[model samples]
Target: MSQYSILAAAVEHRLLEKNSEFITFLQPVSDREQALHWLQHYREHYKDAAHVCWAYIIGNTRQPQTQAFSDDGEPSGTAGKPMLHVLTERELGNCLAVVVRYFGGIKLGAGGLVRAYSAAVSQAAQQARLTLVSPQSLLRIAADFALEARIRQLLAQFDATLLDVQYQQGVALSVSLAAADLASFKLQLQELCAGAVSLTEPTA
Candidate 1:
């Protein structure tokens, strides 16, 4: 299975009629306070707009889930539901979407409201790129002076994420490798250490 990181907070544009506004969404937020914080900030920035309805999905596969929607005073089922629909369709987790509606002075009834809100979020999502994230095994290695160079050279060949390094009586290196590539990593490490290096998995 694969995991994906949420997009960074950024702006993307969507226009309808003579009115145009930007919608922004970002994530990893899993609590009501964080969602409200973003909502409050969004409302402040887009205060001139006619509406600022939003929806959010919180929690992941192993935790308590929460979903919320608000119409910001628009007719019931018009604004917030569509925003929620877009988030669900994308299978997004722990994310929020805010639609800054600039009323074109045109009353878009229920159908139009839904379409506009959905389209705004869709446009923003297209602009905010997502990256693949996966579980990796973190290894902690403590070695004496003689083992440093050989270990560094071996690790250089793979895309190792250096999580941390500490120096004490000896040097301790903390690195992470993709779980799928762990066996190869172990093989290379052992060859470099000549079976002397101690490798241990860190807590997730």
Candidate 2:
């Protein structure tokens, strides 16, 4: 896993093209299931809309683990493809972009439809709040009760998240930290405890 950007929250943007209303919805998603949930929610909420075009990218943006798009009733390569291109070019992952169209008695040619959908998603993305997330791995450590406080301090120093603690026999801790930080964290812990702390496979 690698670092990537995802939407921090949902956002909405609207555009008008030759009287056609285009409503763009931008949302952060962890997987395909969450993306589909949002798509279905919007479809049911906006049942009367002319079309619902959507695209989603999960995992790494540069080389997404999963991706899909739907143009709904729009012409092939018009709505969904253009919207997906915008997301890919922006290097966004774990996110979904949906465009809802309300017909206004005008037809946008294939090229025009592509431009409209792409622009709608682009503008919405510009306004969306984003957060960069790094991949993490779990680790378990066992130390004497006397070293528990110092071990906790080391965990904080390394920015590791404490997941659990057990007091049986000695102090046992489970934590999660960025994979990049694991080596340094282990070295520091060894030095601090003088090799008294034992590292083990993550419990969870």
Candidate 3:
């Protein structure tokens, strides 16, 4: 997909079930490291809490590059799995959700725990704002100086951003555009330049 939904910013929601307090935090996380950093922060801040569980989905939530969840001593599939399901169902990517649960001298069975955790995250997600994320691709092009204006004009046609331009070697341009437009951009560039232009991608 060219674009997807992601968290606009960090958000927190509080839930109460049978005297138990569930503080849910939903935050934008770009990678596993950021997710872990946020999780650790919660763990330290809520050191007195009974359980601190978390789930994170990196990249596209549908086909995430990386994802993981933790029960944090809760029964298997009760806390973490359901929490993750909420994020996936909401189609949110590059996000982390942490629920800090404070026991209230009441024991919730597996079903109750699952419902509480899922609901906690669901409530936060529903209340949180979401922003669109468009995947971008970087490109480098080499063309004659005569095609400078044409190349620059083509960029706007494709909604491309010009990153850099080198005068040497007959105008080398560094540009970025939506990943979905890469193929069409290349084709149109070659056609417009009569196949005299060369394109290359930077090594990631």
Candidate 4:
């Protein structure tokens, strides 16, 4: 199976109201550094907001660590936790949701806070969109000079990425193919080079 990480830029939106606040769901992100970086970037953007409550899920898909949220001064659990829940319910990973409260004067109780925060993340997520990512590996093939032309022709048949060619090293040819296509690619390379090409597979 292919492995991939999600990023914050994948989903983002802003909601603003004098009374309520704005909720922004960032794209999927991995690790603490990236998450903090995004937080600082947006925090500066909405520095004037009353409070910036946020949550994130960092860990594996099967067992995600809990979230971190704050009401900024609102009742606890009103803002951050709910925003995190929205991301969880959607089965999103490596994501962070930041709700910048502008303090609408009227106090939204815990329930009201939850509803608003949840709605913010959900709406942003809905607007953001989801995408699939895949892992790809590279396969290097070293072939005789006479066979390079045929190998290049065969490579064109598939979605292969060529890395480099070093004639100094006995017609060295490097190409990248999806990890899933490794077996088939090897078979095709063997046939194209008539057993004269050496193949190597490297994980990405």
Instruction: Give the TM-score of each candidate.
Output: 0.66, 0.89, 0.95, 0.69
Q: Distance (Å) between predicted and true CA of 107, model 1?
A: 4.5
lDDT of 2: 0.91
Q: Write the per-residue lDDT of candidate 3 for residues 139-181, one digit (tens) a residue.
A: 9999999999999999999999999999986999999999999
Kindly state the number of residue pairs that clash in model 4.
7
Best by TM-score: 3
Find the candidate with the highest lDDT and give its number.
Answer: 3
The alpha-carbon deviation from the true structure for residue 52 of candidate 2, after best TM-score superposition, in angstroms, is 0.5
Any runs in candidate 4 off by more than 4 Å, and if so which? 2-18, 25-35, 55-85, 88-96, 109-111, 129-131
Clashing pairs in 4: 6-28, 7-27, 7-28, 8-27, 15-22, 19-104, 29-94
- Candidates 2 and 4 compared by lDDT, better number: 2
Candidate 3 matches the true fold with a TM-score of 0.95
Q: How many clashes show up in model 2?
A: 0
- Whole-model lDDT per candidate: 0.73, 0.91, 0.94, 0.72
Model 1 per-residue lDDT tens digits across residues 1-204: 345454444545665743545354544465878888988988898888878888887643223268889999889998788887777766555677887777666677788777777887777776665545555788988787689887777677778787887888887889987777888988888877788777888786
- Error in Å for residue 80 of model 3: 1.2
Model 1: pairs clashing at backbone N, Cα or C within 3 Å:
none
